[model samples]
Target chain A: MRLITTYLIGLVFGVGISISGMANPAKVLNFFDVAGIWDPSLGFVMGGALIVTFIGYRYVLKRPTPMLSQTFHLPGRRDLDLPLIGGSAVFGIGWGIAGFCPGGALPALGTGSVDVWIFVAALLAGIVIANIIQAAMARTTQATA
Target chain B: MIETVFTPFQSLFGGALIGLAAVLLMATVGRVMGAAGILSGLLQPQDFQDWSWRAAALVGMISGPAALMLVTGEFPAVQVPVSTTMLVIGGVIVGIGVKFGAGCTSGHGVCGMARLSPRSIAATTTFMLTTGLTVYVIRHILGT
Candidate 1:
């Protein structure tokens, strides 16, 4: 019951981005396209996201936790380390090349284009591989610790 | 700072939509409402109970954008600067990075970091720096 709704809202956001010209991979590519009339719609998406996230948390914070679940599930803590820096770089590079970020991928797939699907498959493979690597690393760390 | 970073249209509509969706998801689904986690669920074969919602959510993500464009009007076609090979290579690298970091941008950057998760902060910062460096290298150094 609860879970269904989450996906629906997520879908709404995904669709919103797609329709507004944010989700299109080619369009996303346009921002990095510095040559033409650079379409900065994606930036608007992120910027738009940043604003909503800011206000949303503010309201969520006052609630003692959240109505959906337990306490306000703010992040666990803060640290600047290798993994963080590395992952973001990967994200940026990937974005530059394909112009298909995760969120944008969703709408692209919705368009039912072959290229989008190819990217999606690749993206999923990446996720699975990452999970496997992380699991392996955890095992190694635990054994060492 | 806000205005400088955000466009007028984005600040109002985008922000409102995000807030609306976030609050709605929490109310209806009882989840933190992050794209990375939700997509993960779709990727894995879930127990019948778990999989349906993920499937629906995944559908929503794709369909939502599509539907909007159809109704409103249309935008120009997409275009990529680099070759397919480069794109694939970058994706594979990002996958490795996400795995090493134990989360993606949406996971750590938006969801986890907002909660003050130490791991997320580190992860988000790292992702940002890497992105900046990579862009510089490609555009400035490599001049690609």
Candidate 2:
């Protein structure tokens, strides 16, 4: 039941992304190219999404539990950590260079583009490397303490 | 220097759908809709119990676009201005960054901001600023 609901939601999300031009790399790139030919369309997309989500979260959190799950699985951390800032900066550079974020890239696979395949493969490799680095960092911390 | 056409109506309509999708996920499944987090979970599976929903969501994401193509008889036009090597490098960087940051545009930008998470707000700001700078350097300064 939960899986079905999540699937349906994902479906809608995918469709929304497709229709909103979020799935287009050029569109995304334009959003970041402020000094260049900047397109403010993505701003509206973000605004529209934020407004709906802001209201939705407010109403949903008031309930004891979500409709299907026992509790809302929201992020709990609030610290301004180095990883968060540094990682986001790095991600932004990549986003600007390639014009593909995780959300945009994933749905784009449907288009069967070779470049998308290259990006996705490289993305997976990077994730694997990140995991390895994280594990090493953890081990070092454990050994030190 | 490049003239580009903007689609305000399409963006708003699509963005509203994205938000509605997020709301539906939260209201029904009790999960925050983070695309990077969802993809990462599918990558590094630790347990089977949660895999079902994650997989379902991923399948839905992929198929949703596929369905649109089938219905509209047109695929969304996409252009990657960078070279293949640049694309690969960018992809790797994005993968690593999202993993380290624990979220991406969807997780931090949309959902995180909605919840008013301080961490997400900071992350989103950092990325947006960085992206702007990066584009300026690449497009204007480097002229690439």
Candidate 3:
């Protein structure tokens, strides 16, 4: 039951991304290219999602616990830090260059494009490398402490 | 120089569905529906239960085109004008950045922003600015 719910949720997200035309890198890039042939459609997508999510989160959080979980797994961090800003900036540059953020990229994989495969393979490698770097940093902090 | 036509109706509907998906994830799994975070978790899963759902979500995402095909009678367009080298470089940068930043579009942009989290707000703003600047430099300044 839990797995089914999760799968369905993913499906809904995938369908949403497809229907919104966000699965297309060209469309996404256009949104970022203000000086070029700009498209504000992506903004509407974000706005619509934000409005529904803002309301949905409120209602869902009011419950004592989630339907299938004992606790809400929300992020607890509130402090603004360099990693957050710097990392996001880097991510943005990549996004602008490729016009394929994870959300868009994941759904696009279904299109059977070799380029998507290449990007995803590279993304996985990057994720693994980042994990290694993060682990090393943690160990160094532990050693100093 | 290709034109991207406006799609307000479809965008809104799709956005709402995505929002609903997030809500469903929260309601059941009690987890935020961040795309990169979910995929990242799959790389180093803590347990079976954890791994199973991530796999399911990914499978669903990958098969999403089939779903769309069923509904619309054609696969959604996926234009990749970026070269292979750029795609790899961009993918790696995005992977590392998302890891350090702790979220991506679905996580920080949609879910986090909805929650009114300051960190997410900052992250979103910073990324948005950099994304715009990067595009401007690439398209306008560099004229690539």
Candidate 4:
């Protein structure tokens, strides 16, 4: 039942991405192009989503616990760390180059483009490498201590 | 150069849909709808109970465009402006970056800001600035 709800939510999210023209790499690239011919449509998309989520979170968090899960799994960290900034910067460069973020890229696979597949594969590889590095760091720390 | 087009209505409408999806997931399963996190969890399954919902969300996401095509008899046109090599490079970096940062646009940009998270705000700002700079370098400075 919970899984079904999540699925439905994902479906709506995908449709929203498609309808918003976010699934199109061209549209996404235009959003970042502040100097050249720019498109502010994605701003509206972000604005619209933010407004809904802003209001929605206020109402929902008051309930103490979620409907299906035992507790809400929100991020608790507050510090502005190196990983956050560096990671975001790296992600941004990639986004600017490819014009496809994770959310935009995933739904785009439905278009049956080979390019999406290549991007997705490379994306997975990146994630795997990061994970391995993280694990190695953890092991090294453990051994040192 | 690609022509710039604006569609405020579509963006708002689609963004609302995305917001609603996020809200639904939060309300129902009590999970933040971060696409990268969801995909990562699916890839690395920490627990047995986690994969089901993650997989379901992905399936739902993939089916979204498919369903749209079925109803409208057409799919939205997509164009990859960058070369395949560029695409792969971007994908890998984004993948690594998201992992290190702990969120992406949906996670930090949408849901994080809503929750008023300082980390998310910082992350989002950093990425936006970097993306703008990257674009400037590529288009204006390098003239690529």
TM-score of each: 0.77, 0.96, 0.98, 0.97
Tell me, by TM-score, which candidate is best.
Answer: 3
Off by over 4 Å in 3: none
Residue pairs in candidate 3 whose N, alpha carbon or C atoms collide under 3 angstroms: none
Better of 2 and 4 by lDDT: 4
lDDT by residue for model 3 (B1-144), tens: 467789999999999988999998999999999999999999899999999999898888888888989978998888876788989999999998999899998999999999999999999998899989988998899887
**lDDT of candidate 2 vs native?**
0.86
- Across A5-88, the per-residue lDDT of candidate 4 in tens digits comes to 888889999999888888888888888887897999899999999999999988888988889999888888899888889999
Candidate 1 vs candidate 4: the TM-score winner is 4
Q: Provide the lDDT at A41 for model 2.
A: 86
For residues A1-145, write the lDDT of model 3, one tens digit per residue. Answer: 8888898889899999999988988888899887788999899889888999999999999999999988999999999998899889988988888788999889889889888888888888878888999999999999999
CA error at residue A105 for candidate 1, angstroms? 0.9
Candidate 2 lDDT, B1-144, residue by residue in tens: 334579999889888888898888888867778888888888787687578788898888877678788889888766777789888989999999999998998899999999999999999999989888888898899998
In each prediction, how many residue pairs overlap at the backbone (N, C-alpha, C within less than 3 A)?
A: 25, 0, 0, 0
Give Cα-based local distance difference scores for all models: 0.59, 0.86, 0.90, 0.88
Clashing pairs in 4: none
- Superposed by TM-score, candidate 3 places the C-alpha of residue A133 at a distance from the truth, in angstroms, of 1.0
Stretches of candidate 4 exceeding 4 Å from the true structure: none
In candidate 1, how many Å is residue B9 off?
3.1
